[model samples]
Target: ATTATGGTVPLTDALELAQQGLPWLMVFDHAGVPLHLGRTKRLATPAQRLALIAALRGCSRPGCDAPASLCAVHHVRDWNTHGDTDIENLTLACDRCHAMVHDGPGGWKTVTLDQDSQFPGRTGWIAPPHIDPTATPRVNHRHHTSELLATTLARIHEQRNQEREQRQRWLSSHTRHTHAA
Candidate 1:
């Protein structure tokens, strides 16, 4: 497929390229019948890019410090994988980091953390098992240190609360057994 810049893009990348550049795309069935218009939630508009810049602040790859201005909006689920261009499915990634993501075993993976996670609505990077044995998905807090601190404190508080509850349960159970005795 050809882009508006007169450059040729692979068929797999055409949708993403069009989403970033074209206002809308029309689809036709094999018989030339009109299909669906693709303008809805398929383009990463300027507003969406700005929102991503504010949220991600920079490349979503963990430990990468590339600034947001030097990054491109990337689909977390991937355009070819039926991923929409919505803001929630988007994150910023530098050229280097962007190329590192793929379906291969050595490639990196990006996902949107669930709302109940330590970092909700954030892009998480899962490294290959060779790089990280546990394959834990981690977020980059380089551009937003405050969030790192906040999440850490929240985890500590939650752990302490769980410990306290466990202790209370043990004490209550011991007291009941003593009374029964």
Candidate 2:
């Protein structure tokens, strides 16, 4: 497909080009090391890249349901600080979550399973500033409750009713004005 830049390139063509002529070998002379193609020049085997992409196809956050294509690949540890460009250290985060990670006043924090007893076998990752440091983090069950779902449905119904009432009032006023004219 052609990009906005008007350059047309097929995936097959790009892959064929990448495979041709030992590209990594050519680039190694400039940097004195085998360079990884995608994330930050750190050496990554093809298998690792594929795994990372698969992991990113779903939302990086533990409970978030956002699709991977809607998210950005984030460095769990900042890349510039000598963080390894490995799948284990990378995550896919939605834009809001990604921004919360980097720009929050206290910075982002991740709780490994070993660190927290409550979230055993799962890494608890939290976006900063919104997270309360002093309070123990707990999963919000209310967000998943049937009552909450019903409440949301009721609110939507109420809004539609208000809109219908407003429309009826407008039509009545217009009709009266037409009759008078």
Best by lDDT: 1
Assess every candidate by TM-score.
0.62, 0.39
Query: Compared with the true structure, what per-residue lDDT tens digits does model 1 show for residues 107-150?
Result: 99999999788777778999998898888889887776767777
Q: Give the number of the best model, judged by TM-score.
A: 1
Error of 1 at 112 (Å): 0.9
- Which ten residues in a row are the worst by lDDT in model 1? 25-34
> Model 2: per-residue lDDT, tens digit, 1-181?
2221224478566556657853331221221222444444545555443443332334456556555456666666677876566655665566876765554476665433343464342224654545665534332221123435666899999999999999999999999999999
TM-score of 1: 0.62
Model 1: CA > 4 A from native? 1-44, 155-181
Backbone clashes, candidate 2: 0
**In model 2, what lDDT does residue 4 have?**
18
